[model samples]
Structure formats: C-alpha cells, structure tokens
Target: MYKYLFLLGSSLAVAQPAMAEDGEITVTATGLAQPVEHTGQAVTVITRDEIERVQGADVTRVIQRLPGTTFTRTGPMGSLTLLGVRGAPAGQTLVLIDGVRANDPANANAEFDLSQLNTATIDSIELLRGPNSVVWGSQAMGGVMNIVTRIENGYSASVEYGGDDRVTASAAAGMTNEKLEAALSAGFVDAGGYSSAASGTEKDGYRQYNLAGRARYHVTETLSLTANARYTHGKVDLDGYPPPNYTFADADVTEKLRAWSGRVGALYDVGILKLNAGFSISDTERVGDDPSYPYSIDGRSERAELFGRVALPGQLALDFGGDYEWSRFSNAPDAGKAHNGSVHALLGYYGDRLIVTAGMRYDDHSDFGGEWTFGANGAYEIAPGWRLRAAYGEGFKAPTLYQLLSQYGNPDLLPERSKGYEVGVSHGERGDPVYLSLTAYRRDSKNLIDFFSCWSGTAPLCATRPSGFYYNVGKGRAQGIEAEVGLQWAPGLSSQFAYSYTDTENRTPGDVYRGADFARRPAHMVSASLDWESTMGLALGFDVRVVGDAFDDRANATKLDSYALGDIRASYRVNDMIELFGRVENVWDQDYAIAAGYGTQGRAAYFGVRLRK
Candidate 1:
C-alpha cells in the first residue's frame, strides 16, 4: 500500500506546475553563504514562515519533512526522542545551534535528545545530508542539522492549550540601532502526558522552561562582535517494569535535566581577507530519583576556534582554521577529562559553469592519538536549468567520556570511522516555482562500538563472566536513494514531497549480530505536505507520513509494523497583529509504535493564538 502511495506522490509531483519561492541563503553546506542550488550537497531549509504555517508542537515535526531522516520516540509529547539520518545511528548525526555543537558529552553515545528542543525562537533550520566531517569535525558521519535563532528587531507572543491538558506560552522582543542589535525570548510548556508503558492506566506528566538571548555590536566598520546564549530546564515523570505481583501502574520515579550553552565571537573583514574567532561552552546536569535511590551526573565542554578566509585571483579562495576543545564528566566515584585540538584547510573555486571544493583536516586526541580526514565536492551546470553534483568524504566519531570512563567503560576502544560518496542530479533554477532532485549514495563504517560479554579468565563460557563491557568489534554498511520535489502551484499554494529507500546490514565478521539489519531503521519512508492561503487571511495545510516495518532490537526479534499518519491544520488572521490557529494530529487515530513496548498518542487536537508587531 505504501509503495502505491509513493508512486502516486511521485506522479503528482512531476505533473504539478511551478508556484514560487522567496530567496533564502544557506551556510551549512560549505561554511559559506550561498544559494542552495549552487551547492554540491543536498540541503533543506525551513524558514520562519513555514514554522508558523505548520505550528508543530516541537522541532522534531519540522525535521520529519526532510529526506533521509527518521525518528523514534518512546511515547507521546515530552518523551525520549532519537533522530537517525541515512540509516546511521542517532549518535552519528551532528546537531548545531548557530554553528556551536550541542550533543551531550556525558551520554554514552554523545547523542542529543530532540524532545528537549523547542521551536518558538528558531528563525531558520538547515539540514545538510550525507557525511560532512570536512567542515564539522566530529559526529558528522551521518549529516548536520543547524538551527539559527531569530535576531531581527520585532515583538511577538503566542499561547496555546489542547490535548492531555497541555499548555504552552512564549514571547520575544528585539531592538536594533546603528551600532547594536539585541533580542530576548522565553517559553514554557506543561503537559499531562500518557503512559509510557504499552499498557498502563497511570499518567506521566512533563514540564519545561527555556530562555535565549542574542546580541551583536559593530565595534568598527570593518569588525563586529556577537554573543548568544540558551538555557533549558525540564522534568519528566517515568515508568518502570511491572512488579512480579502487581498490575501495570505508574512508577514512583522521575528525571530532571538542566542544560545551557553560550558563545562569543568576533568577525573582521578586510578587502582581501576575512578572519573569525570564537569561544563557546556547554554544561549539562541530570538527576534521576526513586524512593530508594537518587543520583546525578554533570558534563561540560569548552572550545575555542580561529579561522581565516582569503580571496585570491581567478575565482579561487583559501580557508584555514584551528580549534581546541576540553571536555569533562563528573559523578560520585567517577570523573574524567580529555582535550583535543585540530587544524583544517579548504580550497574552493567558483566559475560560471562549475563549482568545486576540496578540504582536509587533522585531529589530535589526548587519550587515543591522531587521525586525518579529507573530502572533495563538485557541481557542474549542464544547461540553464540542469545540474550534476558529486561528493566524497570521510568521517570519524571519537569515544564519548561515559563510554571510556564509566563502570563498564573500555579504555582501549578505538574511534569509529567511515567513508562515503554520492552522485546526484538536480533540475530547476534558484527561486523557481518547481525544483526536483534525486541522489544515490553508500557508506561503509569500521570499528563501530558495542557492549559485549567478557569473562574474568581466558576460558570460554566461564560461569563468572561479567555482564558486558564496551568493545570496538562492529562494522556496517548503508546504501540508499533519496528523491525530493518542491512546487509553488499558485499564489499562496505550495507543496513538497520526499522519499528515502535505505538498505543497511551488519558486516562484523564472526560476530553474533552479523548480517542482521540495523535496529530501528526503516527501509522505506515518505513525507508529503500541501499548504494554501487565501487573500482573506485564511490558511489551510495537510501532511502525510509513511514508515515501513523495522526491528526494535539488534537481534531482530521484536518487529514494528509499518504505519501511515496524517495531520490537518488551519489558521485565520483577525488583523495585522493577531491570528488564531488550530490543528488535529493523527486524524485517523492509527494504532502504531515507533518502538516496541512503548505507547503512542491517539487522535489529538490543539488551538492557539498569536500576536506580532
């Protein structure tokens, strides 16, 4: 059934007429500002207008529309959410806020929890698909997702209430002058969430608060200074396994987290050279409690970087940079610190008919050693509205602090490494009403990390064998095809369609998990949306998502069936400064689960209002 739907969507996408697009600039693909059509890599940009039109509860919903991306959540709103790209593990995907890394250093896999992120203050989002380690040092084996916050001068506020007794409110204000510009924003969310267990009557609730601020000062005509900071605090009710003699009910357990990140930077521009330097820090603390036990952990990271770009003759440019990072993890009876430094160089060429870039990086880790990585990308314009692009890159993921210093940590574990390449074709010019693209790529990874059982002695099957310990004993391969189509059908009417087909397999020789499919990765996924607005201040939108069957465990013993979901939303503008909106999610109330033993939300509705100036 999904195959048929995918075919139908493809046909309609090809048959539809072009609409129109506002010109937008993206900087994630090449570390430089440029139009999406000019970059050699696949990129997706979601603007503020799109965010307001869809009005998703969280940032994950906005990301679901991109190609080669998938998400798994334990339950409804405020649940643990993980994101995967191109069949890569969640930890392999790098996340950034205004060019600053945001992954947790204390996590065993150094992965970010997407559920904790709110979209109220985001100005734009840029998703760059495929390996990007040449520009982003670590955790770029899969791709990069960069969130840019709002900085323009304006004032806005919103409030909403809906299903599960959920309440949300947010406000922002900004001002600008000849020498300085500043903005501040804050938001709050509370929800009486559903049970986390597959079958339970007790409800688990959630609460969160967030604050963010940004400012830029023009010290001189040729130099500027900027600073930004964000903080989030959240608490979530938890559920545990059923008791031996008790029925399914809520467990007396909870978890709390507080995290903050900030960065300060300066940019200096001369006629022939541009220089940039920055310093940033991120700190996170988490606490888990039950009647009998309570524990906490802390993680922190600090980094400094300097980079320069020089303009040369003949449409050529050179870029060079270096950075230093310090990471630390602390807890009772466990503490560790590590330092890393890296240098990189890139060369680029821009011409009327071709664009080319090549880069290399060398990294030195205090504990392990040193490694080198390189990449190249090229795009050629075949005609006025047609182009061909190809890219090849290498990526690496260092062992996280928790994986190397905790009780089950392995001090000798090696870093996971990968090599990948892609070739694609694109049609339609920038700002055109219709654009289409298709790409095919493959990646091979080695030294993947996993926990395995180990015995005290050299004997096999020893009775005193330890439960498990981390090891570098895994390998895998992923190959996939991606397709995307965008159309501006008419004035106030627009649509988008995206599809991904991925095939992944374990390649670890002589390992028990060899030949098994990567866990929680669907082989087929599709997303499509259509939106329309009327001159009378009325807007309507519809979206559909389809996910194929997948296994919940590495052994492939627990299977999750395929499912399709749909959503509908509408909005009416009362005046230039006021608007009302509402939405219905899972309109058909389809029974599905992204993870085994987890409960998903049913049909739910929400209503809200907004004021802007």
Candidate 2:
C-alpha cells in the first residue's frame, strides 16, 4: 500500500487548475525558486507580518507554534537554547544565514545555538522539517532552517522597554530602483536576566548587538549580482559549580560570542532557465572566562555553490547544483581542517493537480570519503479542496573536527545516517476559512556517536586518552503524528491549533539505556493561538502552550515536569507611520524548568512602539 501511494504521488495524477496554496513561492525545498506545489516536502514559512505581530525578542516564541517543533532553554531569553524536531538533537538541525552555513565547527556537537539569534532584522524564515540532505549538504539529518534578513525599500524602526530592565532598539533603511537595490539594518538588546541555576540568587545579564546589509545590482534585463552580510556579538553571564561543593549552582562567569557571515551571488533568469551561483563564508569565535577554567574556541567555514533549473516540455524541469565547503577549528580540534564536496540533481514534474520532485546527492568528505542521499516528495489533489502528500528523504552527517580529534575524540568514528518517511492528508486551501492537515512520520538513524567510558575497561585509545572517547555505538528511532487546524471563525478574527505526539526510543542493542525514551523529548505537545483585528486600528492576540512530561536523562533518573504557558498581546496603530504594542508573558507566573536544575522566568510584561515609512 505504501509503495502504491508513493508511486501514485510521484507520477500518476490528472491535470487541473492550481490551488491557492500553489501561489506561494519558496526556495528552500529544492534550492530553486518555485511554487509551493512544485516540491513535495513538509515545510513552513513564517512571514514578516507574523513576526511583527509576535513582537518578542526571542524568536523561539514563534517557532514553537509549529507542529513537531520544540525548544529547551537553559535560562531566560538570552541563555543557551536548543531546538529539536521529531525528537532529534540540536546538532542534527542545519542553520543557514543568507545561504551561508552558520553551524559552529569548533563545538563538540557542531550545533547552532538559537540563543544567538532573534527576530530583530529578519524579513522571512523557511523551516524544512525532516531529513533534507539532498538539497542542503550536511547537518541536515533533522531539518533545515534558513534565516533570510530583510531586504526592502523603506525605513523602519522600533524600541521597547520592559521587565528585568530589558532595553531593545532596532532600525533599518533601504533603497530600491530599477538598477540598484540595497538595504542596511542594526539592532541591540540588553537585559538583566535571572540566574541559570534554580538554587542560585545571583542574577545573570545578557547583551547583544547585530548588523546586517544586503544589495543587488541589475546589470542587465536578465542578469543581477547580489550580496549580503551579517555580524552578531553577544555576552552572557553564566553559572557553574563552585570548588567547595562542585554542585550545580551560581558562580560568577561570563562568555562572549562573535559570529559573522557573508554571501555574494549572481542570478540569471530568462523564463525558460534560471541560474544562481554564490560564494559564502562564516566564522564564529567564543571566549569564556571562569575562575577555575577558561577557554577560547574559533571556527571558520567557507563554501562555493552553483545551481540552476531548466524548464522543459510537458511541464517538467530539471534542477541541479553543486557545492564545495571547507571548515576548521582552532582550539579543541587542534587546527584540523575538514572538507566536503557535493553535487545534486532533481527532476520535478508540475501538473495542475499533481506536483512531485525527486533528487539525489553525492558528498565526498575528507574524513569519511563518499556518501549518497536521495529525497522524493509529491502532492496530489484527490478532490476539490482536498489533497494528499507524501515524502521520503535520507540524510548523513560527517563527524565534526572536535568529535574526531579532540582530547576524547576517536578517529575511527564514522558518520551518522538517517532516513525519514512522511505521509499526510489535508482539506481546504491554506487561507480558507477552515483548513486542516494530519501527518504521520517516522525516522530511523544509525551510527549515532555517543560518549564512551574508559573507566571500567581499556578500549583502543582509552589507555592514553584518560577522558572518555566518542564512538559510533548508538541508534535511535522516532515515530509521531502531527495535526494542525486553522480557522477564520469570523470577520477579522482567526485561530490556529497544532498538536504533536511523538514516540522515541533508544535502539542500540546490549546497551543499558537501550529501549529507554529519548532524553528531553516530551511525548505530547500542544499549542493554540487566537488573533483579532478591528477597523479601528486595534489588534489583540493570545497564545497557549502545553507540553507533556520528559526525562532529562536517558537513564530516566531525572524527570522534568510538564508545564503550560500563556501570553497576551495587543497593538494599536495610531496612523500609517506609527504604532504601539505591548504583551504580558507568563501571565500566570507558572514556575517550571525545561532542563534539570535550570531556572525559568516568572511573569513578565513588555511594551514597545514602531515607526515605518
């Protein structure tokens, strides 16, 4: 039955008029600008309008609204935060900033920290869930998040001040003409947050500043050159164990992070063929100051890519791309360099009622040699106002430099691999009064690297390497159902509800923790929101989220209780150029911790205003 469904979705379907959702265009799915219907991937697009409506410093506030998505924060707003999808860890999610890979290569797990990003200067965001390594090269075993900064012709600014002595300010200006388009933006945030440890009394503080710029020059009617760059610097107070007790508690420590990325590309479009070529680079440095232990880590990555799509007869197109990337770490990895070269191709069929795409990628890594991945997805209109969709994708992640050459590294460690399959049915158009979707998905991963102990017995490098070593000895599987409903109950009023149920297990045989539930992954997650607008220039919104219990340790020795949180917001437009807004977060002051011994924020309120022209 599944094979028939896959074949039918990929090749067999009748022609008809395109649906409303097909009008939306995206570039993350297949590395080409195409209508949403052209790709068969599970994706979500967060528009700028929604970003403005949320009006929060932390972008995770809005990201958690999506089904099968969740985040855990070590402390308040600016502390270390990690996101996961379908029970996968943070390191498996690939993050891109204007086409530049932003994952830090110096980190042991090579994960992108969400705490370094906010909603200040973003124009739009695209989240591709599940394994999509065929389009994005590595670190995409879980998903892909593309953060596209604002590039518009206008002037806008905002300022906000609220609890915890938080102060926020941002501004952007741009110019657009026939031959040239350019923009620049900057933002700053300073907040006195609470301590990270629940038992601590000292308050931690966070500060960040960011600058971004974009430009595009049209040299001819069908040719254009584009460039964009971003830089961010952050400082956060931290807490750690003290010498006497060595317990998780408050201590005077601080960490600073600096990251910068840039991309330059050219585009050529003549209706029949579209091509995009670019070179991108990213660098990150982190310095931590502690009384007992101090450290510094620096990482750099560079990439060159070229991709294009050629339209053909019979409503078909061929998309192809290739990329070469190199990265290195300065500290723990001991200046080791890593390289990967990849090439991919996809064939897409676009019909009135059916849209499907199938692609494959081959990656050559300096450490692991070569790996191949394949992805396929399709959507078919079963009847008026109804559709069915299915997708299958494979992903792989090469061992990071820190994992391979660090003090506890094991050179024999191999790459991790994953496979994901999803199928779903939906009713009504995306903007219709009543729209609903239900999807079921499963993902399996092998060769997962975990920390191995050398205390009990002597392993290969255990004699010299007193610290534990990393080994490819873990396996995992996650299966889940996601449901979403959107309703326009009345004029100027709308609501949305999303729920996720995930079943995750440790699948490594003969392991003490095998068959146990995955750590930090809740079994159930629910979120709902309501928004209303009136002609009188007034808007009101409310959001509610409830998460189920989760274990903080794979051994299930520590449990993190489930909790519910709510927020209310309101905005009023004084005129076309000015607006006022405010929100009360944690309205009930529910005290809960996402991680063991981590403190959480209580009730907090904020107010702000915006000016645009």
Candidate 3:
C-alpha cells in the first residue's frame, strides 16, 4: 500500500510545473568524522535553503515532514514533539547542537520545544531514526537530531520582515584567507498572535534575541583547534488557560529563560589514529512569575565531556570517552542538587562492502545509582545502489528531579528502559536524479512512569493536587514503516514525497494508562513537496502535509482529528544584491490546530525583500 501511495505521489509531483534535481553532498550520518555514502539508519536532512523557502515558523513545522516523526503543540510556545522510530517515547530521542547535548534536565517525560532554537543561524539539520545510543548514549533509544551551524568565510548579512507580527534581523561576518577562519552572528525575533479563544484579541507569543560566534585555527596540517560561543535570552508571556476558557488572561503569568553556552575542541588526524576532545558548558536560568502559583525557579547545569577515537590496523575503529556533569537547582521556595558521570566505548569495522558497530556505556547518578546500555548495528551492500541495514539497542532515561522530588514525589521510581530493533534498505545510484529508502522498526518500553496517587484533602503538610505522584506503571510497544522517495524527474522540476504508518498500543492496565493508545502517537503521516527552478531566475514551491488522528489528553478523553495542510512559496531574483519573496500558509484555508488547545494562525500570507552583499 505504501509503495502504491508513493507511486501516486510521485506521479502528482512530476505533473507539477516546477522541480529540480538533487545535489550531491555527503553528510555526517554514521557517527564518524568523514562523510559516508550509505547510512546504517534512516536519515533525513533539511537544508538552509529549504528552511528559508518554507518560512518554517518553528522546529515542529520543520520536523513534522520527516518520516517516523510527530509534533504536538500546546500553544505557540508550549509544544511537545514525539519523534518515534517504531514507537518510542518522545524522551527517547536525543537532540544535539554542534555535537553538544541540549536535552532539558528538568523533565524526563516530555520533549522540549524545538522551536525555541533560533533557525536564522542554522546551516543544516540531520535527523537519524532508530536506535543510536551506541554512539550518542542515553536518550538516543529512538533517534538522534544534530543541528549544524553555518561556517562563514567572509562577511554576509540579511534582513527579513514579515506579517503576523513577525520580524527578524541578522548579520554575519567572518574571515578565512588561508589558515584561520572565524565568524560571528546576531539575530532577534518577535511575534504576536491571538490569545486562544479570544479571537481578535492579542497575546504575547514569543520574543527572543541571540548572539553566536565561532573560530577555528589550523595548528598543523593534520590538527586543528576550534571554539564556539552562543548566548540567548527570551521572555514568554504565558497565556495560562483553564479548561473551557481557551484565552484566560493571566497578567501575573510570565516565563523567562536566559542561557550562556559554548564549546572548545581540538581535532588531530594521524594515519593510524584520529583524535577529538571537547569541553562544552551551558548555564541556564528559568524564572516564572505567577501570582496564582507563587514561586520562582532557578537552575544551573554545568557539563564537561572528553572523547577520542583511534583506528587500528585493518578496518577496526575504537572510540572511548568519559564525561562528568553537575547541576544545582534552587527555587525561591527550595533547592536541590544532582550530579552524573559516565564512561563509554564503541568498536566498529568499516570495510568496502559491510560495516558493523557495537558499543556500551555506564552512567552513574548521585540520585539513581548506576545503569548500563549497549547496542549493535550493521549494514551490508546487497547490490549496486542497494544496501541492507539492521540495528538492536537498549536505552534508558533516568527520572528527573521534578519527578523524583517534586511537591508530591516518589522516591521509588526507577529509570524507564527500552529495547528496540530496526531493519531497512536504501537504494540510490550516485549522481542519479532518483533515490528511494524504506525502513521498519519496533520498540518496547518497561517501567513506564506516570503521576499516580494524590494527597486527599488540602492539607498544608501534604499538598498533592491531582498532578499525582510519579510511579512505575505500565508497558508499551510501537511499530511502524517509513518510506521516502526523491526525484529530479527531468530538469528544473523536482519533487520529494514521504509516507509513514505507525501502530502503537499500551499494555499498562489500571486507571492510569488503561486501554489507551499512546497519548500523542499519530497513526499515519505524510509529506510531499514540489518545486520548479526556472531558467529565468524564478523559483516556485508547494508543499502538503497530513497527520492522522491522535489523543490529546493523557486519559485519552479528548480526540484531535487528523488534518491536512498546504503551503506555497516563491522567489524572484531581481538582481545580484536583491530578491523578492512571498509565502502563503494554509493555502486551502484549513482551520486546524498545530497543537491542541492553541488556535493556529488562520490562512495567512507574507511578502518580503532580502538585501545581501
């Protein structure tokens, strides 16, 4: 059925007036430094050009188009996305920025809003599906997402302004004549939208400013030193809405986050061994002002990691690394502390026709003892342009401080664990205009934790609202198939289409998670895009996306129906220093919710001009 659907999608794409051929650029996919042709796992990439064309409002909008992925938005700034490879929880996925981990330490059950990341500075993003903990460790039970930043060799600047209360201004300058290269960038964005049920009413959705810089110097022909620094701060006015009233104005509710993060690393290459070591740190502060709630939260996370890889004679490669992380969280009402240490190693063989990898890591936490995870992956060339790959891995997520020591907490909760496997094949001829990839995977989780019993009667000593206490309850499983095709059909005209089918179920009995299909696991998803690059310096693009039905509430009481969305974009190159562009979202005027409870922007269009040097 998926193959037939792909064929039909392909035909429609080809019928489009505009499409272009695919380009060649080997990317980092196999946890290695060098670019490789075949990946041992399902991988999807979004380029900067594509991001600009789509005018993607957030990370959710950009990632939903990928296979085996689903995003649920609670509001403009309140969003939780589930990237399931087979059927893993959203927490099973790991996100990285320039090789540094960025998962929130406050929550272990939900994914942080990917949209919080500024897109203006992103060069490219890589989404790898299936178990990758062998190389990434811990939360990588489902997949890994690596966001790479742009590297500039000279000065470049751009100014963008749009409707819907959207405006962004950015500039970048760098220098690299021969041996040394450095760059710096700054960006700011502000947007306002309707406050939920209050149609015609205004709300403060998002306002943020960011600054980043990087430098790299060649110490020798085979060695280099690189460093990067970035700082961002944002103030979000929380539109705290209760059940019926979608737009409840809470003048007292305001959220603020400030962060300072950076990385310093060195890389050396010798014929027999390749070495890389890096140290990264991110300090974050979160504060909330809600008179109705009453309290302020402050958190500080300090992390240091060092790793190296060496290749022995033959095709054998060995990687060993260790890390230490410390976090001290203090609230105006109280304070807590947690620290972690880990050591890991991976062994792999990369030959002409086949590659095999195995790895393991031991993690120790001041609060949760120690846990170990291991995995194996392999890929073999079956024929020209055809490769078969498989992977099996075990991953886990330790309970967060909020879960273990919240106002109503549980000290007996254990870390959730998952075991998963995936098999797939990829066929693509080098330089060919067409490429196809398919994958199937399954994942099972145990010791699933959820808020359990609550304290009855509002006792001052035991204040446990319905939020419940964290407990190890049910078991869950997920399986799915993903297929993707890309074709540059002829010239100037090209198209890309992807489809996914997922089946998710819960075996956790009891009132907590009884007889419910995972909270936000959409059963089916698809994305298709067509583009025409005119020989006359004109570009046109169209995209369609569909997400199947899924439950919105934890109890599965409210059902959010499936819906399809479409968008169009075009650009005209007027001259060497100027270009005019416009984009229209929800072209069909489909009234849909990108996230439950939050009203999405109605059909809207924006036109803007880009000035560059």
Candidate 4:
C-alpha cells in the first residue's frame, strides 16, 4: 500500500510548478513566527480546514495521523489516553495550550491526558518533533505539542451521534472589531462505551464537558492585551482486574477529573523589538471511586513568563526569555510543592540561502538544583527545489511531585537527561503543491526514572519489598527514519502519505528487563489519506493507517498484533449556512487492541450536521 501511494504521489507531483508559496506560519519552535519549511526542526501543522475534513472529535484522533507519533487508549471515547513521540515516553512529551503547560503535576509521570482535550475550539496544532528543551524548558525530552485556539470572528456549531449510544454537540462564536476580538466555544460528549477488560461484558460509559474562551484588546497601535481560559470535566466508568484479587469488581470502579486553566498576557511592539509577558495558572483534580475505597488527587501550577525578540543589524536576530513556575500536589495522604526558574537566550541568522539558530537555557529547581541545556540548528537552500536541514539538542525532565513525595517516593532521584540529533533533506517549498521529506534521527537517554523494590539496601538488584522507590537507573536509545509526502493534485484533490520506522530498546544493563522493546510503541507506522472537494459543495475523504506489532509488557510476555484501519467520510453543503456529513470508522470491524487487556471499538458510523454564519 505504501509503495503504491508513493508512486501515485510522485506521478502527480511531476507536473507541479517550480516554486510554491508557504502555507501557515508557526511559532512553536523558537517563539518566532516562521514558515515550517524554513525552520531546521521537524514540525507538522494541522489547520482548521484539515480538521473539519477529517471529522475528528478530539485532538488525539487528529494527532495520530502525524509521522513518528503513536497513542494508547484504554477504551472508547473519554478514556485515558497517552501520546508518544519518536519512541519517547508519554511523560517526556510536553503539551501546551496557548503557551500554558497542561501536564498534570499530581500524576506519577507528569503526563497530559489527551483524551481531555477536544477540537471544538482549537484553531491549529503545531507539533515540534525531537528534543526541544533549549527553549521549552523541562519535560520536552520527546517533543512539544502546542495547541492554538480559535480567536477569529465566526460562529459555528455541530452535532453528531453514533454507535454505543454516543452523542456529541459543540458550539462556538466569535466577534472582531476595530480594537477588540473575542471567541467562546463549548462542547459536550456522552457515550455508553465498551469495557476496558477484553472479556468483560458489562458496558462502561464516559461523559465530558469542555468550555474555552479567548479575548484580545488592542490598547494602542503598538500594544495589546490578551486573555484565555479553558475548563474540562469528565467522568468514566472503569473496568478493574477481572479475577483473583476480588478487592474491586470490574463494574464498580469510576473515575472523575476536573481541570481548568487561565492565562493573561500583553504584547508590545517597539521600533526594533517585540516584547511579551504573561501569567498563567492551571489545576487538575482526579477522583477514583470504588465500592470499597475512594481516593482523590489534586495538582496545581502557576507560571509567569517574559520574553523579547530584537531585530539586530545585518541578518542576525536575538531572543531572550525567562520564566518562573510553582507547582503543588496534594491528596489525602501526602502533599508536595516545588518551584523552578529558567532563563534562555537564542540567536538566529536568516540569510538569503541559509538559516541558522543556536540557543542555551539554564534552569534552577528548588529540589534538584540547577541544569543547563543547549541546541543548534541550521538549514540550507541548496537549490530552488531542494533543501538540507540538521539539528542537535539536549533535553531534561524533572521528577514529578507524586514521584518525589508520595508513599513510594524517593527524594534523591535525579532528573532524566537526553541528547539527540537529526539530519534531513527535502524537495519543495513551504507551501508547494507537492512536497516530500526524508529524515533520520537518533536519541540516547540516561538516568531514566523507574520504580523498583528495595530490600537489604542492595543496588540495581533488589528483592521483593512491600513498597518501591523511584530510581534513576534506566538507559535507552531510539533511532528512526520518517518520510512524508503531500500533494494537492488539482483544484480540490489532495493526498498525504507518511511512513515511519522506529528502532527502540532498553539499554539498562544488569536488569531483568534489559534489551527489551518499549511497551505499546510500534516499530513501524504508516498513514495515508486522500481527499477531494467538488465544485458543487461535495467533499469526500478516505484514510488508512497501519501499525506494526508491539509488546504490551516490559518483559515481552504479551503482544499486540499488527492492525490496519480504514475510514471514509463525506460532506455535502446544502447551502452557504448548512452542511451534512457522515463517516464510518473501522470499516472492516477488525478486532484489535492497543493495550494488553483493553477492547477497541468495532465498526461504527456517525452522521452530523453543521451550521455556520
């Protein structure tokens, strides 16, 4: 399938023009707006039009189509979902919502739950792959996902229903005037879902509600103030272990989560410099309720940041920034608090044919002292239709509050560190009708944190103990090649293809699980899509995804077989204000599992109607 798609794309590109204009501009890489093709890093941008074409209800569904990305979801919608980038752990990837950190501080791994995020209010998503700690600070050992919400003046609404008693509805409205722009969106989802356990028959259910708002006021021609806020509440019925323990049955577990975030900032444009300052706060609370026991965990983060970019003489530009963050975690049993301060400086040179960037950052943590990270990237336009890019960077991740102050916590844990590099070549411009890119990268990581039982005060090899402690004793390496091709064949016909080959291994020597592949991470992944829009207001789309087999446990005891999924969607606009759409997922109803004991959705169909201004 991949070979055929590649050939088809090549044939279509042969008749394309020599030069093409750039598409949307991105700011996730270096805090500066630049075309994705001009940046040295590997980045993927998903625009609003593409999102609507795909009919994705959540961010996870859209993100899964990107190269070198994978996700594990336990059950149906509203279930716990984790994302991995380039073979990196879920916690290593940083998630940002309009420049505010979204990772849960109370979680043992400080990972963000992608399931909590819906696409009702999102305008665009910028995925910066590979290590980006130099400018993003900690928890960027894998990559960064920056979500930009809609602030344009418009009004839209949608409603849909499908299998398993699923129902979804969303509404958004915005207005723009001479000096003010504001937008607000809200969404709700409820579904009677399948059980998490493979063999369980009892039906589990999930429900969620989300609301977001953004406002910007131009104080003057040279200054502006902006504010953004979001809230999400979710509940899911969980299936516990089926047998033996009997502590809690599969039908008696439920989990609830509430999260909210708010940010306020100001932007100033001077003669030769741009300045930005912001303050933000976010909180998440999760509660697990069982017939026999109930527990709750809460986390909060407060951040203040300031940055400036100066256009210097010649082709050089300078960027400098500083930030301070305070995080707290609390539960019935214990509480923890920590803070960190970071400062970074970046320099860039943008010439006629070459672009170069270098940056360094210093971070001081209240619990673990200080650390430094650096990065360098360059891109050269070898010809009108060819370009070469290379980048090298370092990354670090701090211990989470749960890992530091919980019952099984270790106060002596060290931060995980990593270094990686990538080189790539591409044919085409930023907005070329047809473009292709091939990239190869490698990353080596050390001091990865893992929980281990400690008995008799032994090291690396410990006996069974009632409780375990977090230790920085693991090492790993990931290498991969990613290829992407995209083309707009004609007026409304387009296609995209992406393939990735990943080689990952646990290099922790002297351990029982040494040299094993990472759990839930596929070694090979392929994604392809074709879409067509007719002049008569009709659109059709098809997508295919294939994932290679992977292990479900560290010991390689359980395996998840390879699976291929196909989906088709169509939309017809009745007029300028109304549209009808429908889609079929898992068209073949192939039975598969992304996790060991979880059940995946089967053939399902949904129909929806959209109304726009």
42-143: candidate 3 lDDT, tens digit per residue: 677777777766664355666766788876554454323345554566677887666666666555353444645776667667787776655665677677
* Rank order (by TM-score, best first): 2, 4, 1, 3
Residue by residue across 484-585, what tens digits does model 2's lDDT show?
A: 898999998999888999999999999899999999999999999899999999999999999999999999889999999999999999999999999998
What are the per-residue Cα lDDT tens digits for candidate 1 across 1-613?
A: 3223322322211100001124656566655455676568877888878877778558877888889999988866677788899999889998877666788888878887887678887877888888877777778899888887766578999999988888988888998887887888877889898888777667888898888887777788767677888898999877765466454346776889898888877766675786666777888888887554576878888777666679899988887766778899876556888988777888988788898989998888887788888988889999887889998988899898877877767777788899988999988742258888899999999999987656433423223335556778789999999998989999999888999999999999997779999999999999999989999999999999999999998999899999999999999999999999999988999999998877888888999999999
Runs in model 3 deviating more than 4 A are 1-31, 36-39, 77-87, 108-110, 197-200, 241-252, 331-334, 429-432, 456-468, 509-512
Better of 2 and 3 by lDDT: 2
lDDT of 3 at 487: 88
Query: Between prediction 3 and prediction 4, which has the larger lDDT?
Result: 4
Candidate with best TM-score: 2
- lDDT, candidate 2, equals 0.84
Count of residue pairs whose backbone atoms collide, per candidate: 1, 0, 9, 0
Clashing residue pairs for model 3: 18-531, 18-532, 19-492, 19-493, 19-494, 19-531, 19-532, 20-493, 20-494
Pairs clashing within candidate 4: none
**TM match of model 1 to true structure:** 0.92
Span of ten consecutive residues with least summed lDDT in model 3? 12-21
User: TM-scores, in order shown?
Assistant: 0.92, 0.94, 0.88, 0.93
Better of 1 and 3 by lDDT: 1
